[model samples]
Target: MIRIIAVLMLLIPGLISAYGIKLMRDTLFNDFHPIFFHIGIQFFAGFLFFLGGVAFIGGFIVYRDKKKKKQREDN
Candidate 1:
């Protein structure tokens, strides 16, 4: 159950990151999602989403790696 939850958490952020990329790409083509009123805002929001998601996933990996390394050293 714990593993399933973890996978879900990771999957959500991965999807967000992909959507962010799509948003940015669409902005470049002068296409905008209705929620965004301005082109610049859309692009900026996309940038933030992409970076935030990636940072989260990256941090998770780093934390897990450190935990594993500590366990190895302890044994």
Candidate 2:
């Protein structure tokens, strides 16, 4: 479901970001390619976090409003 997907978006990106950081920290860099790749991954992780937060908040708002609306209708 959408909720599951949103949660996964947060988790997967977080894991990838952590792994990327660890890789960059534990390895010696002599070339530009690894640095560039890390930057790209970090950017992607940032984007995923932003999108996931939006989706999670939006979904919560929609669900709350819908529930309230249904209660009003029942009254």
After TM-score superposition, what is the CA distance of residue 71 in candidate 2 from its true location, in Å? Answer: 11
Quote each prediction's TM-score. Answer: 0.86, 0.44
- The regions of model 2 sitting more than 4 angstroms off are 1-37, 70-75
Report lDDT (CA) for all predictions.
0.88, 0.56
Find the candidate with the highest lDDT and give its number. Answer: 1
Candidate 2: the clashing residue pairs are none
Candidate 1 root-mean-square deviation in Å: 3.5
| Sliding window of 10 residues with minimal summed lDDT for model 2 | 24-33
Per-residue C-alpha lDDT of model 1 across residues 1-75, encoded as one tens digit per residue: 999988988898998998889889999999978999899999999998899899989888878888787534444
Error of 2 at 54 (Å): 0.7
TM-score of 1: 0.86
lDDT per residue (tens digit) for residues 16-43 in model 2: 5555554444434432344445655545
